[model samples]
Target: MISRLITILQESELLLSDQEIESFSEVQPLLNDEDIADALWLASKIGSAYKVSEPAAIKAVSESDDAIAIEVIDDNTVVVAPSPMVSAYMPPAAKSDNGSMETPELGLPIQVQAAPALAHPREISRSLRPLLRKVPSLTRSELDESATVNRIAERGIWLPILKPSPERWFDLELVIEASKFSFIWQETLDEFQQLLEGQGAFRNVRTWTVKEAATGQPQLVAKRQQGTGIEQDQPLRSPKELVDASGRRLVLFLSDCRSRLWQQGQIHDWLTLWSQHGPAAIVQLLPERLWSQSELDVGFAVQVGSLMPGAPNSKLQIRELPARTEIAPADTLTVPLVTLTAEALKQWALVVAAAGRQRSPARLFDLSWVSDPERDQAMAVIQPQSAKERVELFMATASLLAQRLACMMAAVPVELPVVHLIQQELLPEVQSVHIAEVYTSSLLEEVRPNRGRL
Candidate 1:
């Protein structure tokens, strides 16, 4: 308190005698810490407010603002009128040469950047336009009868003379597996949901996150808005809820297909029920090249074509589907797996709508992967000890994109802003998932958690 008083006296341009400074010791004990703090704050505020003085000037009538006035209302008291334009509590604003108050120049508004998707968003959306759908309701939607008439005139014989309706659509449910490995596809699935909504191919596109419940069964959950403006998931439903036996709901599962459940037959069981009831399929996140490495068994490769082929009389003739006489019973009934590519997706939609007439082009996964995976093949495992060895192992096992990003980031060694720079400027294909891959690969360390720079 005594030293503070001395400093306050010095700032006021007043040199106090040693004896005068010592006199504050006598009053220091009488004031509490709160009182001392208030005094110091007030002294500092007054010092900054009036560090320098200038002559007062009046403004024109057009800008006639409220003026602050000090009035002697009592014998030993003064009442100062408050001005709203600039409060006395705040430090006075500095004016420019033209007499206008100066402030920092405004900059652009900040925005949060979204993560990049696996493929071009628009292209993927366009490719999904031919998803297998139930027959559209001709009565409820606009139809082109001219096309039906033209088709009848072109063909010598007329069938039902039905018109095609594009507007009538059904509800769709997209279930994304909420697991460590599967979460990497979160950005892709989110963009997919938005694209489905934009396409208006479904009456309503509902998104769900599938997670294991306490009962050890995988349950489906949907996110809902709470009254507090926060998001919360709805109560998880039983596995049976995942299957609409009436075939009214269309469900699509976005998964990496490497989970333990897939090998345990749990995923297959649910898919069986869903496929039996309604249009259901799995969208594998991994590329087609890596499909063999996943839990899905490498079944016999067959070309999926239409049920009828080489009908010259038919205006729209499709290739013939594979014969069922030679194929095993297991291959005839199995869940369809598809990649995000247009060709794979188109074939999947065909098999889905074929309704027993045709099956997926991909092999019917064998139960060997689920029952006895180690029967024929020997597993090779390596334990890396050194950091360099660990990094080498990670690079060997990581995705090609992640490996590329890790090499680039290692060479550059940037910190926080490096993500946007790499994604936007250096490599447009770089995704937040790839950056995270490098973070988890043991190739980078958190040098300083609190700092923006590393």
Candidate 2:
């Protein structure tokens, strides 16, 4: 193995960079020189993982990324990589209710669990129907005006400061944990449609033509509503439009909640229809997560003099007041720079909001819906803090989602499952450093109808 791997590495040396060679060398000392063949093979594989110029692909498999695929050859001889698109192996730490475990013959045992893991499927689903009906109805009612005002008043002064206080930090962590259900456990509607198509609930899923604004060429948009017998004279501009169209796929494209559009009469109308005449599924892929901030900001303080044209020494200074008394002088705190512009303030607001979401439980989750034109089918982009938290939320989301879905699908004679993809990142504009898909479930088996007495 050592001789063959060495030969392969020597042949691929031209493709491999010096930095990659160094990375492999760091791992080599832990391996036995006698068993150098396996070490060489591991090193060569890792070296090949790094493309010459492709940063995205490189970042995906890097050691720093939340590596779903990991092999522990030994403590020091661990091999790790990004999770593959599909695998036969059950995710790591996958616990079946029956306490049965299956190990595939080909590879190592995986450590990740799939999403939507539910215990009491029937009772949960039944309870969720009322809220599924109520929230949307309230959003659409004439009382929406008062509801919005009341909601804002109820969530008074939730945003935290740039530097979190001890109490605020504890609150943020709780909120992040609670809101992980929306962020971590999600999937594309198209993927879910595929599962339903197999179950015969959804048939004849087809793509439609929508001309791109930038290029006159047609863009392929999945129009699953085609065979569902819902017709519209004009294209659906919003979810409110879907109500009149009476389509199976009434996707409320709420991309942002902070905007005024979400609070409008259209959202109210859309929600009313959703509650009254339910769709087969209400899969909200994008939950109001920490990463829901419109702007990504990393705050910095620069001296007022640093902004002057031709100022060679452009460095930041933490403005501190001189101590009035000898004892108090040493305890003086650094003041916020006054020179910060409106853009900087806006940036700071996003940072604070993001931080507060991660730190403060006092900050309420924004459940309002906003309009988006890009996505035709459902898609979710999750940003949970950890893999374990993501897995827990995935199951909770499935259980919660199953109940709502049960209400929607109750009208339909056919038993339809609420499928969650859990892995795909629908939004590319989000520049998240650490994120991963924890799991996907069709919810068919997990959310089975009550076999015994209700």
Candidate 3:
């Protein structure tokens, strides 16, 4: 019976390798009914597995001069199978739910368990199956197959920064981590130099000048040495000489500690100082973060000269003073230099308002819609009139569009009409309609000409 089975396998061109056949011969005496059934099952499985790998195997085996074919009959007769002049091709089998074939038991006087291994059938099929029959030895391509499968299953590449291009008229400086002073110092100096060099009313402007503000006899020749920088010194020459050398501008002096303290009340005192003592058209460029802090109290000092009745001399007195204006910083601070244009400011304000609206429960729709189409559709449904309301509507529509797009891209089935309804028809109508009552009414009529269609 064993020889008949072996001959049948060989005739069908489902023969095992020489080594496998030898191993089977040694174990043939241990076979039982269950072992026979398992062997038959394995043969059937090998047939199915070959379908996937047959093309490669055939190409390999057909190249060998020793390749042979065999056939089997239902009556258990064995015969030589025919070989095609050119290799024949077969389509891979459709995947099936049948578990992998179990190995036959050695025909020893031992109890056998019929249960399959704990591993999945697909895994077992891949591990043990051969691609072609009556062709030399079968080689497992498990690793290569697994790698191909994994490559096919992978998703898109994720990057840390998605937006690589900078927006128009906007400059972005990103620093992972650094001290604030070190970061700002070079950038600020460069910007200031550029502005000075550029053609403008303030081009080649000077910030510092020294002149005697008092007149008096040389009662006590008190010499005071000052820092050598342009803005740090007080003039030693006579009042007329000083005026001729520099300009008739009042001087102010503050310690480095005082300057740092004044920065605490940045926006208010800085603006005030510029308005009062500095040039009428001057602007103070300070750190954006420093200007944002609202707690600091600031003070300034102005120098005035008292003329003496006696000789060609003066008494310069430095008087402490208060600021002329004050303002608190908003949550979103806008740098006047970068976003100075009216249109840019307006757009920025809208964006900030939209961001705020997204945080509110009542404005949940704003967070839902992101894409322009969906936002327009949602707006069509819930038409907003005011600028603030429109921003809220756009945000809600954007959120909804994002959610729908994500669902679609993920291959998770979703209702098509719902996606279209929110993104297409509704959002466009809302975005197009003007805010005026008459205009809005006409627009609505034009958008929904067939009221029953929606």
Maximum-TM-score candidate: 1
Error at 71, model 1, angstroms = 33
Q: Residue-wise lDDT of candidate 1 within 93-114, one digit each (tens)?
A: 6887779785433345455564
TM-score, prediction 2: 0.19
Q: Candidate 2 — worst ten consecutive residues by lDDT sum?
A: 168-177
lDDT scores for all predictions? 0.57, 0.29, 0.27
Q: Which ranges of candidate 1 are over 4 A from the true structure?
A: 1-119, 132-134, 138-170, 214-216, 225-231, 239-249, 297-333, 340-363, 368-386, 394-401, 411-421, 430-454
Candidate 2 global lDDT: 0.29
Give the CA lDDT, 0 to 100, for residue 183 in model 3.
21
Error of 3 at 304 (Å): 27
Top candidate by lDDT: 1
Alpha-carbon RMSD, candidate 3: 34.2
After superposing candidate 2, which stretches have Cα over 4 Å from the reference? 1-187, 201-234, 237-265, 279-282, 286-454
Candidate achieving higher lDDT, 1 or 2 = 1
